[model samples]
Target: MKKTFLAFVVIVILLSCKQKTGIVFPAQWQNDTLQQTAKAKANIVNNLAIDNTYQFDSTAIVSGCGMVALQKISKDYRYELIIELILDSIPKYKQFSIVDFRDHIKITLNQYSKDNKLINDICTDTPVYSKDQKEPITFTAIEGLMTITNIDGKHSPFKISLTTNNLVFQNADKETFLLPKEEFKDVLVGWYAG
Candidate 1:
């Protein structure tokens, strides 16, 4: 009886361990915390239209190739954004530094169909030289259906797309209804989960 009990306990323990490992996600899972954070940071440009109060660090710039790390405050519930500033400092030419001339700031929004086909893409030229330089870009949301598409991949069966007539961006001399910083966190949380 004692031996039988011990064996049973071992079996149960082993099964539990296997279950935990099965649920453990690899480092690159799309919905994983890291991916979510990167998505959230990238989504910051969208958030900017909602809230202008939230300011990003000059070092939080994104590059064509870079590392983005994310942390989940709640499981698929809330998240924090952290960015490792990697500026491309390579010399493009003998006279000018590549990093110095790169577009330092950019704001953009995009929508796609369920087929992974891009429907619309809008972006503002990011200003690099002056902090006070105003961006004349704006985004407006249109009322419509948004669809996500399945691209060739072994990952999640669905990608994200947006459709709405409400989104809009325009230049404002003072704080306007379209530009508020308080909506940043909530907008991100919704987009991250949606």
Candidate 2:
């Protein structure tokens, strides 16, 4: 009887140890306090408007491959705007219209709604989207201006003003979306290995 009781106690201890070591959560995922603080600092002010009808706040900035991309999503996650600018060198105060860099710039607007379940994906250029897709619908920016200022380093604050107009979507049924203007001031910039 003494031997049997000892064996039972040993089995219970092993089972408890196994359960405790089953799942391990990463240290970063355990708390999001740092992430929230970082996000608030990155997007100090984000005001985006399209055709004076749709308005959104700036979300985040992601950078890679000599380019910095600004993203804005609606509160409902129904609309997303991505503007990618390729920069070879840091410009303290550079201003250019959309027509100036037809190939170097990419502007994509995605709409997700119940009516259009798939997604209404449109862009000013195609190269940024994919290199394998045979055909992609491209848009034309008739008039627009973008300015970047106060770029010091990877973590320094910067400002960007983007105003676009008359984005013509080329598809079976051509549609035109009006100006999408956004201004971001004193926003922090960062880079990761992504």
Candidate 3:
């Protein structure tokens, strides 16, 4: 009985040897999924303001690596963007991605501006990139307070701030700067709720 059972198992294995079973994903498919999810998140994020909806754009993911996007949200049409990334994985001792740009929106608050009031106006300094570009699309500070108010008076106000550095580079030894090759790096990290 043992011999017969072993022989049956061997025959079954041999019969199934030629059967190929594997999972193969499309090129950039994961990246595409990440982008899709990001876009969905952006849709919700864009509608955050009661009076103003933020306009989100994708900059760079990783200079020849991953995916990224930019979110611009503000009151009075004040321009601010945040960078997001979706990568296969970060290699050992490697930078994720980078975006560079030369546009910024400054915040000028009213006289009654308090710490809470300034939260909405503050945004993380982020970079923007394009296919044919090398430097950032917007150059601005990322670690500060921002106050976003409802221009339509239908929504309340809110604030946001980044207390740490959140910029990602291409790799170690390369100066932490933005590059326009891999993915978009322009995004809105967070906003206030009011």
Which of 2 and 3 is ahead in lDDT? 2
In TM-score terms, candidate 3 sits at: 0.17
Tens digit per residue, CA lDDT, model 2, 88-129:
532336666666676767766555553322222221233343
lDDT of 3: 0.29
User: Candidate 2 overall Cα lDDT vs. reference?
Assistant: 0.48
Number of backbone collisions per candidate: 18, 0, 41
- Per-residue error for 96 in candidate 1, Å, reads 21
Q: Could you give candidate 3's per-residue lDDT for residues 1-194 as a string of tens digits?
A: 99999999986775576355433346458888889988766433223212122232343121111132233333332233443322123221233222222123221111111211121223334434334323222333322222221112122221111111232222122222221122222222323332
Kindly list the per-residue Cα lDDT of model 1 for residues 123-193, writing each as its tens digit.
11342343433322332221111111111222232221111122223333422223121111101111122
